[model samples]
Target chain A: MTKIAKTSPESVRTVACIGAGVIGGGWVAHFLGRGYQVVAWDPAPDAEQKLRSLVDSAWPALERLGLAEGASKDNLTVAPTLAEAVAGADFVQESAPERLDLKADLLAEIDAALPEGVVVGSSTSGYSMSEMQVKAADPSRLVVGHPFNPPYLVPLVEVVGGEKSEQWAVDWASEFYRLAGKSVITMDQELPGFIGNRIQEAAWREALHMVAEGEATVAQIDQAMTDGPGLRWAFHGPCTTFHLAGGEGGMAHMLDHFGPSLKAPWTRLEAPELTTELRDRMVEQTDEVVDGRSTAELIAQRDRRMIAIMRALEEVEREEAAERGEGQA
Target chain B: MTKIAKTSPESVRTVACIGAGVIGGGWVAHFLGRGYQVVAWDPAPDAEQKLRSLVDSAWPALERLGLAEGASKDNLTVAPTLAEAVAGADFVQESAPERLDLKADLLAEIDAALPEGVVVGSSTSGYSMSEMQVKAADPSRLVVGHPFNPPYLVPLVEVVGGEKSEQWAVDWASEFYRLAGKSVITMDQELPGFIGNRIQEAAWREALHMVAEGEATVAQIDQAMTDGPGLRWAFHGPCTTFHLAGGEGGMAHMLDHFGPSLKAPWTRLEAPELTTELRDRMVEQTDEVVDGRSTAELIAQRDRRMIAIMRALEEVEREEAAERGEGQA
Candidate 1:
């Protein structure tokens, strides 16, 4: 095996996106908006049109966030085939459907076709990179670079590598995501659901239990978070929030106060049986909350709101940066 | 028993904030910033000066958010005693220490001194209104109006009534909080720890479990959240974020896909025993994250970031309100 050095994040200009559904299309838009030449491919016949539409819809919001120098939708090229998409690309992002065998095959194909040492990433939400890397030829360079929905706007991207993956590739992906204006979490190991989804799934399951038990309506639960801890979550995680809640003692004092309550029968991590009755109640309650908005309409609304938050956070960061520079001067 | 009519939220001009710790001082700053005359009381001899200092420290950020008409620190008055604070108050907010006995005695004193039908809300994070109301002469008006830290910035206020609480008093408190620009979750029943704290406690326990197992560091866990799902959490609760993640099919599809993985035992809701070793590690890791910054500095940073997020959210809300008004027109 020839030793390979990892690609520099800034040196990579042309990026490839495979599978152009919501996640993939969002990636395409994000890359294009950041001044990367994005070549994308999807098996769906209408994927090109849909990808373009996703990019178009995201453009106005991206424009507000300020695009990278020379960044334009004209930088995107929708390839007709997977191989064509990755043929001359410096990096590849596979956002295929969530089937294990399908992802394994897709990653293997991209691995076989890619140039030596050119790393490839999967935008998988739950699949561990180890499971998907089993079939890849250059498994050492394949990493999981999981991103949240509307990836063009949300700053988070969980980057990790499988057992077969080399450290440099993971580092490359982390740096690349950061360079692309993302807040990246590079995991030391291939934790299931990475880190984000596990916490989310835990909380989501508890929420389902609450709904199933009629402890709270869907609307009330949403309000409980949005108007409560969710606000703090925007800037700090649960641990840090607890640290702050600890007053001057920090996390130690927090544990002493609430440690016993953690054992109380307040939250159940087990998935509630999704009975038809429960399902109907949730759907009805959610429909009531959402008020007859189509999925597309809801998605648009989410994207718009996400943009506002991202822009606001960005402005704060920029202002803080300027202030720090002034202080240093 | 005669039923009390709810006090008009708009009629509230003077508010009383009892206690002058961080939470109480925050409430005083919030009330004054909202253009209400705030009369505050605390038993500590230095409380008056401390309360004034807190309000002064918080004033600049509040000013950036744009003060309510006539809002000023001059509106805050440090009352000589608890009774004097509530003497001419339109509403009373109790943010006494978290000890139940102290709060019980304090609430009873306030109830004895308050004008008839004036609602008194306690900012208790752990105790239910029912527990705290046990000592009050008029328990009906002693509802829980729990706000997050730095109550002046976070919009969430969990309002719940005790068993003896009058429906009209709860309604009056809810309307008053909303009028003052707070998001109110009028919980139907007093569940232990209320809703937000339970969820937070659950997640906090799991985070401790990970820390004990050496799965991640304090910084890693925090980054895993703030740079990962924490962003979405700002706008959507866990359920909605998962629903959005399930593609066009919604929550039902999401439940079917990821529900079982939840039971894989990644998270332990039962509290992990906080060993001295674990506690030390947490303190040290947190110290590294805090990086020699004083607690006061960390709080200032948190407050600044929170104000930025709040202002941004306010902007989005203002635009949406305008859009809705146009639609109605």
Candidate 2:
């Protein structure tokens, strides 16, 4: 297999963020923090100010995590139009709303002005790359590089390619993300929610079922994840955690011990389809749980913790690297 | 309704850690860090040294999170016997090997020496409090307080009651954990894996099914959590995330939109019973995925990230508290 050359942020001097919403601002923060000049476009009248504020607020966290290596507000500029945003850009990230029509229209406009080698990606949560690339003039250049929210802090970015997306595009995008300090997972095929969302959806489905059946309360279900697998999943991921659950036998042992339980009809897997009643119950329950916590407060809390986690990880990585270096010496 | 006095750590002067294994060592670190004198008991000749090393390693991470307030080796004493360990203890935490008979036998010894008013809690992951207390002189004194691995870092501690466990025991244990800066979720009754473990089991069961069916690789399954819900879950619990998923419709909208998908045949809720073949596959896949990472290495990584997250949460809490204080002024 031929190794594809990765794009370093330094090498990609210019980038564009299309549809400067919450996620788009994250893209700007991430790109600008890594030292790439960003040209962002959003039709919203307050888009520029919103993006600026978001980027500015995220900077301290970015700097704390060493993500602000080459960042400065001067490196970011708001383009009046989408065509102008894609002009001279090596990378373009679309954070448009999740409507398929809106995405297709935006991508078509983007494709018309996109540089020959520019890799255009979307931050769409549920849309497949195949669907998004269908309307693109050069669909081969499109990739699905969906990132978790507050992207500058969360390391995960799912990299997927459409049928029209070239292998090189996937490889190149993966490398670009790696250089930008994001953990990249390249999907073999595009699936709804890709890998992360699917798993989350699965878990969420089961949790909702539990609530629908009155077997567990909303707080009980949430507590189960946070106090249990949530803690482990944040660091190790589900596969590894289950692997550990297997004990000395690994996943096999875990399966042998608890496999019988999985067949229990009690799973409530058929959770009464989320009726309006259930939805109201869930909202009321959640509001009661979060109480008056604002989005800003939540975001700040999230960023502070994420930085701390990243720093600790960096320390561990450094120590491991030093040990490896010592061993080699 | 008479207000129950909130359980606080102020009254907990001594904590006896029964069975000085990894989990027990974690208990010692948390108790001592929170200013309680920790008395540990184990039959191993090097129990003292092992406990000391674990405590020492835990201190830096704990200190980083502002959790290691009064931590000191001098505050930790290794007892020659279980009886000696609980002589003056205000709380007894048993982390003995997961053998029912062994636990039963040990509890009898521990119960004989526990000071009056002290809460006796087991760290058993799935065992019922009734089972552990079956051998106790006063079963009402026993409670199930299961902490996630490396209890010193992960804040969740599931406080469950058996048929015999008194309300006061649960309340006192909850308060003690809160004072130690742990998040406490009380289960009204005993269930296998309590709250966190059972939900995790549900997810894991499905994850195993996915792997067995070859729907995804170990890495893919793991990524699904880390990159997707895992990221959201690190900050907000599952219920809140779903509530957000509902968007404007909140949980009700989310249920309405995604509820139909719940009944899909693709839902892995009907997991195959853990046949021997499936178990082997799980083990083989996990080993292949994990490569050769040691438990300690994996745990250290987990601890490092957890500390970072907790520290971040603490900062947010501090900020919120400061804001509230200023508003009052």
Question: Which RMSD values do the candidates have, in order?
Answer: 14.7, 15.1
Best by lDDT: 1
DockQ class, candidate 1: incorrect
The estimated TM-scores of all candidates read 0.79, 0.67
**Residue B65 lDDT (model 1):** 55
Deviating ranges (above 4 Å) for candidate 1: A256-266, A269-329, B5-7, B256-329
Give the range where candidate 1 chain B is weakest over 10 consecutive residues by summed lDDT: B278-287
lDDT of each: 0.73, 0.68
lDDT of model 1 at residue A186? 85
Q: Best candidate, TM-score-wise?
A: 1
lDDT, residue B178, candidate 2: 79
Kindly list the per-residue Cα lDDT of model 1 for residues B1-329, writing each as its tens digit.
Answer: 23564357898999999988989998998899899999999999899998898788778657755689999999988888788889899899999887889888899999898888789899997687877889777788889998877787777888889899988888899999999988888888877766776666556555555555446556666667766666566645665555555554445455556445545555553223333443333333333333454433432343344345545655666776677785321
Candidate 2, superposed: residue stretches over 4 Å from native? A1-11, A41-88, A101-117, A135-137, A206-235, A238-329, B1-11, B32-88, B100-117, B131-137, B202-234, B240-329
Chain A alone, model 2, TM-score?
Answer: 0.77
Q: Compared with the true structure, what per-residue lDDT tens digits does model 2 show for residues B85-199?
A: 8998878899998878888888877877765567788999747778777787767778888998668766789888789878988888888787778788887766666666656
Proportion of native contacts present in model 2: 0.37
